[model samples]
Target: MASEAAPGSIGGAGTALPRHVAIIMDGNGRWAKKRFLPRFAGHKAGVEAVRAVTRAARAIGIEAMTLYAFSSENWRRPEEEVSDLMGLLRIFIRSDIDELVQENVRLRVIGDYRRFAPDLVKLVDDAIARTAANSGPILVIALNYGAQAEIAAAARSLAAKVVAGEMAVEAIDDAAIERELDTHDLPPLDLLIRTSGEVRLSNFLLWQAAYAELLFVDTLWPDFDAAALHQAVTTFAQRQRRYGGL
Candidate 1:
């Protein structure tokens, strides 16, 4: 487990806790392999980790938490695995909805829902609606998501507007693209963390993470805990955050 001091204790990190944090949960298969267990077992453990981290984030006053759950590239995996992931999603929603509402967490999913099965889509939509009124942490799950694909989709929409004379070609810019994204209303990511020692973005939030602080950890997704999350936030607070300019 990772470790960091309690939240709001000033004078050490200069009150640098991030308001928003994003995570790319990685290495579930590898973790299962190491344990000589089925890959789905690792995924199950990762779900528990998600629960722990979410509660921890809320406890620390984080305003937003975005999790890269499934990427567009993940569709290439075996059909069985894909189906298992979908099952897990359903289980998560069913098991957590009441708890989430009680905890005041609003859940939002960002991705191409058109690709999901009708039953799964209905479950996701129901979860969103149920938690929409929550006033606590905003939990964003990126399932079936791809940063490149998101950008491409946004561009296609913008291009169509230009062709239809609804928008001038010259007027198209960053803000316009952002408005077209699935996460338009959310604030930019303040910290991006990846588990299982992976060092790549894996096509997650490419546009929004342009100025985010990153924390890499070797712990597998299943093993990530509140301690790990706190450490990540503490590390984020220590950074300079110069953005694009010094």
Candidate 2:
């Protein structure tokens, strides 16, 4: 467990209590490489980090937390690595679904997760259904997701609506496009953090993070734990979000 991060109080650290936080978990392969271990070893280790971070975020009163589990480009990796990742996903859901249900965390996913094998898809769907009614924190996993594709798809949807005379083209503003986005149900992204010292978005959340606070740290995904997460949130608390205004 992490030391409590006091995001509700804003006196000392300013008023930026991030309601939603997203993280780009990176450096798993590198972490394994440095240890002379298989890349799967680091990825497997990263799962523990995910669990710890989820628990810590829930404890901190975060409304929603999104993790970049797999991007569309990830499929281009070695087939063995991809298979290992899928196996890990199955293991995580099977082993942790009960715990998530007990904790009242609602499980949700963005992207074409069905692209996975039918058995794995069923497992994921069952897990989602199991936690659909939970009233606690929402956990969003981006599997096979890409920001550019998401935006382009949303635009296509709106364009289709225009063609069908459902909504006029002039009405397609920010909110309109947002409704078609994968994160429409989740709270507005308040903080976007990338581990492993990566500063770029790397096609994570293009539209939702227009004004979100961005933080990059050098911690590897496999080593990221509750304390690192709490520290990141505390640092986020100290920043003042101008949102394009002084």
Candidate 3:
């Protein structure tokens, strides 16, 4: 079980803020249903939430903020929903890439790119290339990412190296595995937030969040805003990370 921490004061002043934070955006469908709107309406609003959270995170001194935008399991949803999601992603990239670059926010997409359409793949690649020179806060989008799949893939790579005699079996360690993970270049995950009161990791950064502080809130993804982000970070600042030590 993960350790629990008491909610801290609401301001980040004089507190240690997390360098890396990840969020599991949940309850979009529910939010839309409550408004008697289509699910896509909720997703569209969620995009706005993303923009707000990105700006807030950068302003709060966070080095990296990863958002669980899409999961491998999400493919099971209706076809129309999937297509709408893809469209929204394209719109987001085309519309927000400039602002991201201007703000010095490096955009990174982590997941299986092969599963996307050619144009979508190109958009993601181009976004990364355009922001490659930026030296500021990083925004990682976990699209079609699954933590267990990532772990298995990393293990296979290590096994292949051992089979080719490029790396000894005994040389495989936590550090080595980490280098193979998608977030190897980013800072360690410090805080993970899940909206809609979800209490699970949902296959998000499982390995990187080994010692991260988890905060679950009742606010739906579409309703999440900069203020909500600030509150979460403030709560994180008050946590005690023992990392298995006394």
* Candidate 2 lDDT trough over 10 residues, lowest sum: 5-14
Model 2 TM-score?
0.95
lDDT pick, better of 2 and 3: 2
Candidate 2: residue 234 Cα off by (Å): 1.0
Deviation from native of the Cα of residue 136 in model 2, angstroms: 0.9
What ranges in model 2 sit over 4 Å off?
4-7, 10-15
Error of 1 at 133 (Å): 2.0
lDDT of 2 by residue, 1-246 (tens): 664545564333444568899999999989999999999999999998898899988777778999999999999999999999999999999999999999999999998899999999999999999999999889999999999999999999999999999999899999999999999988899899999987799999989999998999999988888778777877887788888899
Per model, how many backbone clashes are there?
Answer: 0, 0, 0
**How does each model score on TM-score?**
0.93, 0.95, 0.94
lDDT of 1 by residue, 143-214 (tens): 899999999999999999999999899999889999999889897889999999979999999999988998
Ordered list by lDDT, greatest first: 2, 3, 1
> Cα miss at 173, model 1 (Å)?
1.8
Off by over 4 Å in 3: 1-12
